[model samples]
Target chain A: MKIENIKKEFPIFNNKVQNNDLVYLDSANSSQKPLVVVDRIYDFYTKEFSNVGRSVHYLAVAATNLYENTRSAVQKYINAKHKNEIVFTKGATEAINLVANTFGQKYLKEGDEILLTELEHHSNYVPWHYLRKNKGIKINFAEIDEHGDISLEDIEKQITNRTKIIAITHLSNVTGAILPIKEITELAHSKGIPVLVDGCQSAPHMKMNMQDLDCDFYAISCHKMYGPTGLGVLYAKKKWLDDLPPYQGGGGMINEVKKDDISFGELPNKFEAGTMATAQVIAFNESINFLNKIGVENLVKHENDLLNYGEELLRKNNSVKLIGNPRKKGAVLSFTIDGIHPHDIATILDEDGVAIRAGHHCCQILHDKLGLTASARASLGVYNSKDDLDKLNESINNCKKIFNK
Target chain B: MNLKELYQEIILDHGKNPRNLGKFDNFNKDAKGHNPLCGDKVHLFLKLDENKKVNDISFEGEGCAISMASASIMTDLMKGKSEKDAKEIIEKFLDMIKEKDDIDTKLLEEDEKTKLMSLGGVKNYPMRVKCATLSWHALSSALEDFQKEVTTE
Candidate 1:
């Protein structure tokens, strides 16, 4: 499990992307999966496939146990107090929508405000925006500082009597700013407000503890964690899960149904309706195990070193203006070239087999605030090395040469 | 497949200093175009004379080299053409970008055909075809006075 040899685990690296080795820096969008996680999906379908929580057949029982085992693994991985607090959805967007719909249905009233930061991805903001339209709830934003970090003071300043919930990103996908989630949660709790953290960018790269951070709801994207697509995890406190109304109704999430009256199932099942992403849910356990084997601290250290190296290298390159420069940052390096648009930069970079994300990265509000239409982002992951970033720098230089910068 | 074909000297020159890259007062028709994927945008303004021929054309926005150059070249070629001729040229250019092997230069002169043919490189880059066609789409929408903004989703 040497960190340097981590790239060998991902089969993508074994092949060439357009006749060049893949310098994947788009992990913040979605991570490249390891062999174990990919194999788990194949093995589950080939050998041990069954619809979970359904029939009493032998394969069904085994599949049920394996599915629930991943739930327990997720519980322990995020250190949630209760296993039932973890609910699986299609993706992080669905997880946030579930919370917003259920919470808005039960608690949010007219004129109630949900405080979000400028760095929130559209997934985090759009779901709450539904409440603004339907329930007449107001959404407020905490502005980012010059360095693009959202401070506890900024969160506190936006809090008022009408503010009901505080939703924020754990780490900005654009700026790489890691917010003070624990302190923000503590502040919200002091004001008797709940906090929802969009951990799509944070959960894969950093350590997370539900009880430690004390956020009421945390949404995670499994694909971004080197797991399969079409699966996400929502970690909420037991009380919130217990109190919130069911998001969607179907066969699996029902306790009793009659012609006139129906009672929903309990905790995790209440949130998860119909046939879930069975193979993806089961395979995600390998993703958790993969992270555990390499260890979060090591991944954090490796990514931090890569980020610093990338920052220094890109900083030295003239006309490559790095965005944010937050005191506490993640593994994303978002920048813009002076004479070239980000799309042009990405196109040229792709010519060299370097995969980076360009455009708003789903943070249009932040981009507008920064007076930019788009930017090029090179995000890192566990498998990324300094060599990959070196390629990014070289490709950026090639882009400058092509753009006549 | 060929970056050189996509980033030709003419294309780079137009992208660097785009032609008609500003708003014009007293324009009769205007339309905005947006590429949501890349966040590139273009606002095309045009004035048609009594004979329905394009008297002036201008654009204001920012985008990639392909998009800016496409808009720049499009505006330069669109001026002085009838609305029907402009529509036909847009269709021909868009057809070339999508699937057509070559544009019908019968509607265009030799230099106009050459300038528009430079963008034929976009056909090799599937993701960027929209960038090369966005301004053309906006111009078409402006001709019809489409109420909603045109978006290359």
Candidate 2:
């Protein structure tokens, strides 16, 4: 499929938003779903609705196969060695919380450190903070450089003998800086420490290979991947999943339940407690197929072009300070106008049907480091185009005009 | 829903050069307000005299034009008012923003009423109503000697 035609695949663009075409630039927050993914959800609920991994009924068996098919697709898509390594959670927040809860239960101890970066979203940091409060674990941050990039050296410098695990973002949602995960994992492994990569910002934009990256644990947000809300994928090595205790205990995660004793199920089921997001899991197969049809390489090329164009255009505009001049950046463009607050800028931009995110973007630490209270971010997905960015620039100019800057 | 109404010139003026935009030296009462949604913050300081009159009032923080302007105008109008009257004005202002009813502006001068009315644009924008009300809530908390930090959740 042609990259320009990608917008046509998303049904949201077919309708007008407040009498204007939607110039969606908040994909890093959550991507707009394509028609295939949306229709798949409808078709599943309308025709073949049933709970998975539960019953012997016809719809139950069919739903079970469809649900597991998505698991296989995700396993192949990320190139994980084993399909059972993929466990679904509510969202990336839950996935990270699952790891923190299970890992803290078994390995982490008082005074043990978990190395993080300044660019981590609240989802990645807050889970580990719970360990700090409950398990008395200390958390250290690897500082970002002047360009907002966290280098391998930063990670190595923060590693201590007490450092048990290093959790980091593969791609920063705010600065668009892609961390050196493969190298970070290699370094962490040399010290006998595990690493968890928050792939919420990375999974949807780039190709991911769990085996190649060699990170012990990685969490992905399905909603950001244009799949659906209420679904997340946690890819852990088989060894860790087996060794770690079960996160939550309930139905479907049990092997044998007695009044006196209880045993747990195996692999993914051990982590997925209660009824799963059956329809969302089944529908997400179409999201993977949609990406496969267009191809990640083509999508990357198209987005890089848009990012570069946006960077150059905003750079030439006076009083607009673009954040993070990383050597390698993604399609995220975060900036602050000199005289206008980000909320004002966002409010003005919304009048033009330009949907961008303003504020900390859930990275309060990074915002403090950058000396900014808030920022305006224009992030791109496969469907974004240069025309959309042009409207964004125009709307920014209007915002400046309103502020009389 | 109109952007021009929300971003009126008076709001921009107040937001740019906010009045009493600093901490008080000997504030008898103070409280912090935070809007976690957008990371907007306001720290309100009050110096109430022995007669229960507001000898001085000030604030320090960062926010959007609507919020900063609201705080600036609020502090400016709150000076010299009794604590009871100040609380009443806050209640009236919050009521107006929530579109409950027209507040009794008899206690306020015509100029002060005009300045307060400039913030009425927030009534049209639901998401921004918190921005306009955050500092007022903080002021109320300060007057009542509430210990917890006020949050526009």
Candidate 3:
């Protein structure tokens, strides 16, 4: 993929921010919108805007076809066996919550273990905390080595026969470490426990095949993948999705309503409640096309090049401590200067027009494990170039000079 | 983009050679403040003279140069002033961070909001407002504890 041409696709890249060419290095947090995705959404509001699966009017028919059409497109994009197996939730958080509420309510009993790795994001961590507190389900961690690698050894150590489910992230948002999802999933499958892979970080830039991963549930956010915000896809095995109870109860999730005893609609319909983001969902098809046009493999290769270069620079600075040092990581590079706090690094870097994420990246538990409060993170996306990283490198170097040991 | 532009070299010097970095085992009052957001923390020790004047202030923490410099500055500002005026100065600093409308730092007769204009740069970036204010918050918390102990004892 041509990185410069891809930059042209994001108008935000064309405009100056803070009076400088916006060096947006914060894609792991949220991505800038491509012009095609933006225009698709705007055109829907201007031309064909209506509620999907409602009304017999032409606009409604067009909207319904467009909205549901994105489902098959996404199913094919993720390689799920059936379109009905895909449920559209608000975002990855909601997708996880849907499964948590339904599966936690039904399958998890007192003392049932839910396995998670130390590299899991807070979104993956908190919902299970709710389950553990409310349902008496036990939560256990698969150990992360000093380098932030999650091994099958720890998973096996933590998994007793009582282990009911294993929820893991496909990639670590902070360390950029890629989890062994296939091996992890296969391990869980051997014990007959379904695995839920949080693909919020991986689905955007990495190669994601629901079938090949063989995980029962894979959750993703649309905005993370160059689509609009407020939408995510939850891919589940057909039987598991069919067996799980309805998550949210409201309009459009019903087959028939009686005075008493209401029956719910089937599969994906039962999960999505109330009025959906019709235009964004319809616009999401354009995102599917966008991803298809610039293949996921090429996008990964392009981003990995940036990550590879950034890491080399990061390693040269002896004062900088790279958090979650691992054998395998994603495009995210998180570190902290020895004396300067992550907050200071973030502010100074922002002044230089280098927009990188600084904070715990919402993984507080990992920070606690590392014996630090928060670490600065520089995450890459499609449009980032060597120049963008050079800015980060320069700003960080200035910081090191000021706080020289 | 020199360090002196935002951070005076004096701040870095003070951070590198912090005055009150050592422990104060016995003190009139002590309090700890932790910024859960960035994980910066400070344990402040205050020694007051017989006339209710600050004899000295010292601290120990893991923080950025700005925060440590601000803490060192806070100690410098505290020793010469009485407890009452010291409290007022802290309030002024807090108001500066709040960055309320109609704040005039230059007009001394209008009140002591001028001390706050020193942090006007914080207005540019919303995230660092908390980082700038964390030291002030920790100082206020320490003072509040001191006040509570004085009333009871």
Error of 2 at A204 (Å): 0.6
lDDT of 1 by residue, A1-405 (tens): 779999999999999988999999999999999999999999999999999999999999999999999999999999999999999999999999999999999998998999999999999999999999999999999999999888999888888899999999999999999999999999899889999999999999899899999999999999999999999999999999999999999979999999999999987899889999999999999999999999999999999999999999999999999999887999899999997889888877988999999989999999999999899999999999999999999999888887788
**Which residue window of length 10 is worst by lDDT in model 1 chain A?**
A339-348
Pairs in steric clash, model 1: none
lDDT of candidate 1 at residue B148, scale 0 to 100: 91
Candidate closer to the true structure by TM-score (higher is better), 2 or 3: 2
**B22: Cα error in model 3, Å:** 3.8
Ranking under lDDT, best-scoring first?
1, 2, 3
- After superposing candidate 3 on the true structure, give the runs of residues whose Cα lies further than 4 Å from its correct spot: B1-4, B8-10, B100-117, B146-153
The CA lDDT at A261 in model 3 is 84
Calculate candidate 2's fnat.
Answer: 0.57
The sequence of per-residue lDDT tens digits that candidate 3 reaches over residues A117-225 is 8888998989889998999998998877888778777688898899999999888998877888898888889989999999999998887788898999999989988
TM-scores of the first chain across all predictions?
0.99, 0.99, 0.98
* Candidates 1 and 3 compared by TM-score, better number: 1
Q: How many residue pairs clash in each candidate?
A: 0, 0, 3
Candidate 1's docking class is: medium
